[model samples]
Target chain A: MSSDAATDIMDGTHSALRTHGYAELTMQDIADEAGLSKAALHYHFDCKHDLLLAFLDRLLARFRERISDVGGDDAADRLLSLVETVLLPPTDGEPHEFRTALLEIEAQAPYDEAYRSRLERFDEVLTEEVRSILEDGVAEGTFCDDVDPAEAASFVVTYVRGARTENVAVGTALGDSLEAFRGYVERALLAPAATSVTDGGDADDGAGDEVDGE
Target chain B: MSSDAATDIMDGTHSALRTHGYAELTMQDIADEAGLSKAALHYHFDCKHDLLLAFLDRLLARFRERISDVGGDDAADRLLSLVETVLLPPTDGEPHEFRTALLEIEAQAPYDEAYRSRLERFDEVLTEEVRSILEDGVAEGTFCDDVDPAEAASFVVTYVRGARTENVAVGTALGDSLEAFRGYVERALLAPAATSVTDGGDADDGAGDEVDGE
Candidate 1:
């Protein structure tokens, strides 16, 4: 089979997996869905796991490409752009189904080693990108001086992940949720004085107080 | 069964649920693990769903009880207290198993209606608590004049949830992670001007500049 033809078959199989979930997906189902011979499917991928890993690999590559396209004046803007890109819904003709598939794979990765490895690598790339942005912010005095870029980046990524999970929870379109999340992220990353309640304002002192009796 | 005895069995089942995931767990396993007969288990919980709901209900009660313990201050202190309480590991012997079980149930809630209801209610309570805190802060002027306690509280809860998920991911002892998360939360909650940067001098703009880049 031609390489281009094999790539198309792989894409078709990934689409099927997204719609049918991992457990219900089968080689025959993918081949039939792709209108390819079962043997031909095997020619490209040994099994479902290989195909899933490939799908994730493609996702990471796409993310890297988008990151490359995202340019900004400083770390904060760059970080925001990076987040906005992921959180925003794709415009016309963008490969959204792949994202949905990758999300499913990420949710299920904990139970699968190969999938988990792929996800860890994906996470590493994301963290690295975020870390670079944060490092820039600190150097440029755009963010807090003491902010640990890696730790802050980890929290930021986790926050986005949580927001995405929330979006998934309410069944909100990923695109719309991404917009709301951008607002939250903007506040979260803002320089401290811009939004903090400190400076002897009616600040809650850093001590344990009661929950509701006040 | 005596009310106390029934409660004991329920707690036991909930405890077992935490240590074992919902999908991988069984009533028989809970019973065996709890050292109780299947009859005793059924007498307390009609089925798994009922049992799961009970566990959630108990968690809610515990949360309310904890919240109610905060007093002797305005909303800011109370709000901080609530966060502190959440940050502190459950020292009341709630059992590490309970935390694990709660995480499992929380993870599954997105896919289950009853669990979802419980989860929504959980969020509602947290949001309300935050609103109250913000209201108090506004009245007392401890928080910023422009601060919206309700929104701040929402961000706080989301941050906590995100932190909890990360703590679980790292698989370290809960106490240490909780402390680290508490530090993060404290910093995030404070007015930005308060957190000292590594250098003695503050950044050029105490307030962050907004970049027009998207």
Candidate 2:
């Protein structure tokens, strides 16, 4: 099958999963949603599990691309941008479909080892990205020397994941909570000199120079 | 049905939900798990939804009781204990079955209005308890006067819920993250005088008197 055809089939599977959930999903439903014959859908994916795996791969790739595109020269800015990308609802104001779908998929993980392993891999990649940022920040003397990069990265990932999960249920913006997290990062993670230079009363003056260097 | 019999039924339902998840759960499975005839199970709860609702009610009650029983004289200690009770895995190292079940139920919330409403009620009750603690702390000058109890309480509840959800998938104890949260509370929420008096090098002397007051 062409890649475009596979994409269309996966998109249909996503819609079906969202509407009917994993347990109730069926091949007929996916085919109807995709506006394709059952044989055409089967040509791309032999079964529901295969289609879901493909969909997950696509989602993870998109996530990696988005994180990479979160552009900023300053390490702190880049970290903050990554946090926003991971946690915030999209600009279109729809309930976060990807996250919602991921939760459903995760529910099946206990029974499906493949799903569980894929999720673990996704988590490791996320934790590594955050750890890399923390390591860079510490090496550059931008973050505190005492901060354990691994633990702090785990903390950030866990907290952001938690916030995203709660937001789905409560329908509330986590903006205030994110602000609180940022404040914690500034106070507890940033080196004193960096904190003073970046967030002090004269931040505008110092920030301009930093931006120019970027 | 006797209250004891009802409790047994709910317990069995909990086990079934944990093992098979909400989508796959059936009344027959719960009946078998409970060692009761199908008719007897039906006598307690007419349908799966009714049984789940009852189970959630029991869970909420137990949560309230646990929070109330968290013995601490100081507001900060009480708050910390409350956080531990809600977020930590059990001492016996069992996976958090109730929270795992909750995640599954929450996934069904979009399609189940009854579950959505019950979860909202649970969230409100939890938020209120946290808010009440913050208010008490502020009145006692233990927490910062500038802290918005409502927003801060919401943040705490949201973060804890998120942590619980993620822990279900990742199999990590939320211990380190909880420590981070406590650190945030001490630094950002406590009044300076209270923080120093409670956590400073001279805390042993000051805390003795506070403990005596209790």
Candidate 3:
């Protein structure tokens, strides 16, 4: 099968996931969504699991590309960009269908070890990115020296994941969550000089809302 | 039905959740797990959703009871106890089957409005408890005065929920997560004097490991 056909089939799987969820996802539905015959879908992916695994790989790669696209020499700005990219809604303000689908896939992790391992690998990449940024910030004297980069990275990843889950599950605003996380980073993670300089003028500024545009 | 029978039925549902997950939980499996007849199980809960609703209510009530059972005059200690109760494994150190089940139920929130509302109620209760404790700590001059209790409570609740999800999803150790959270709390939430005193003697102490027993 051509790579284009596989990509088209995966796009159909994404739509199927958004509409029907993982439990109700069917090969027929995916093929129909893709505008491809069932036989053509089967030619590319032998089973629904195979299609989903490929889709997940694509999703992870897309997230990595977004991270790398963040351009800045300042570690703090890069970290903020990473956070905004992960938590903020798209610039078009469309509903987060892709993230919603990924969460549905993650729900299968407990029953399927392959899903669990794949999700873990995704988290590992995110954690490594955050850790590297924190280390850079510390070396530049922008973040506190005493804090462990790995633990801080773990906390950031956990907080963002939790906030995203809460937003998706309960209709909590992702913007509100990003603001709360920014507060934590300002007070606990950043060095004293950096905090004073960045937040000195306005103790209760609404600067967090500007993160998405950056 | 007697309350005892109801409790027993919920226990059976819990076991069913652990063994088969929510999607595959059947009345027959619940009946078999409870050692009750199918008719008897029907007497307690009309369907799987009814049984799960009852089970979720029981789980929330048990958590509230654990929070109330923490004996301490100090607000910080009470807060720590609450955190420990929520995140730490049981003293017996068995696998976290109940929490695992709760996480599974939460995944259904997006698809089922009833589940979403119930999980929101659970989170509201937890956030309220944390907010009340923080207020008490502030009043007692043990916590920072500048921080908003509601926002801090939200962050803590979000972080804990996220950490629990990560641990359940990826087989990460609950102890390490609890320790990371403790570090956040000690550094970010407590008053400076309290931090110096509570965490002064041992900067790199393995104090988090002792929370399971305390």
Candidate 4:
């Protein structure tokens, strides 16, 4: 399939998932949302599973794109921005419902290698982003020298994954967990200079919300 | 139904889940495992969903009991014991498959209030345990006074929930995460006095493995 056409289909899959959810979503529903006939949809993808895998691929691509845009004056701000992105509640709909649709698909990963492989990309991408941010922070003298970037990155990603999962499964407010993560970054990751610095003021300025962005 | 009968049914549910996994499990399978007629199974629990809720309740009760038994010389050991319990892969069976079944149930928590409510109890129990442990560590001066028990407990629980979910979804090794958590506790949770002490040496004695029992 052409790149543009593939993007269109992935968008359609998102819409159909929003409407019908993971359990009830059908190939025909996806095709309807894509504005393609059933036969045309099948011409590119063999089944709903293949199409959903493609949708996951698209989602991962978009995730990488968004993560790449995460920026601030320093590493701490950038890290919080990434957290904000992950914990972001969808503005247009019930965030819980959307996460529920996602949880259903994730539940299948253990049994389905295709789903598992695709889902693994999300964590890998996030872990890499976090590791790079930590490296940047260390190089800039914003984070502790003793800290291991790779381990801390893994821990952060694990926590992020856990925080989002708990929020969906237990109804912990997204904002609450986001704040919890912010506290962790401040206490565990930041160097004394960064936290207690006279010059670098972004972290302590109380304008964290404004800078973190929507 | 009698208490004995209820326990029997729950045990049967475990066996059935083990044999058939979550998705293919039928009420009849449960009945056969329990050595009950299908009518008896339906009499106590109306459907698989209700039965699963009851099973989760039993599981929570067991979790609390096991947590009560989690003992060590100091707060840190008890804490690691707790981690060991949470990250404990089953001894005799396919641990990943068992986790996958549990993950499948957890996936339903968002849309299913019965499951969500039941599952929420697990996190609540674990978080409370963690908070109490932190409080003990603080009172004993084994941990930093700057730490907030509630927030730290919440963070710990969230990371834990995420770790288990990622393990099932992406096949991340449980043992690897348990070690990562140990590192976090060492660097972030322990007071410097505790870490630098020459007398009380369990944490640093290289016997951490033997002390943190299975």
The prediction achieving the highest DockQ against the true structure is 4
Q: What is the lDDT of candidate 2?
A: 0.71
- For model 3, the stretches where C-alpha displacement exceeds 4 angstroms are A89-98, A195-214, B89-94, B196-214
Worst 10-residue lDDT window for candidate 3 chain A reads: A203-212
- Order of candidate numbers by TM-score, starting with the best: 3, 4, 2, 1
lDDT of 3 by residue, A13-36 (tens): 878877777777899999999999
**If the candidates were sorted by their DockQ against the true structure, best first, what order would they fall in?**
4, 3, 2, 1
The candidate, 2 or 3, that scores higher on lDDT is: 3
Worst 10 residues of 1 chain B by lDDT: B205-214
Candidate number that wins on lDDT, 2 or 4: 4
List of clashing residue pairs for candidate 2: A162-B162
Ranking by lDDT: 4, 3, 2, 1
Per-residue accuracy of model 1 over B1-214 as CA lDDT, tens digit each: 5877656666677667666755567888778766788888887788878877876787788787777677534444466567567755446544445544555555455456788788777777876877787676556644445555665666566655655544443333435434444444334443443222222234244431111111
Which number leads on lDDT?
A: 4
Question: How close to the true structure is residue A193 of candidate 3, measured as C-alpha lDDT?
Answer: 52
Residues B1-214, candidate 3, lDDT per residue (tens digit)? 8877876787787777777766777999999888899999997778889888877788778777766666544666678778777788355422555556666666668778888888998789889999999898878766778878999999988888887778777767767777777778776876665633244444244332222223
Query: Model 1 compared with the native: what TM-score?
Result: 0.71
Residue B189 C-alpha lDDT in model 3: 72
Please tell me what DockQ candidate 3 reaches: 0.60
Name the runs in model 2 displaced over 4 angstroms.
A89-94, A138-145, A174-214, B89-94, B136-147, B186-214
DockQ of every predicted complex: 0.14, 0.42, 0.60, 0.72
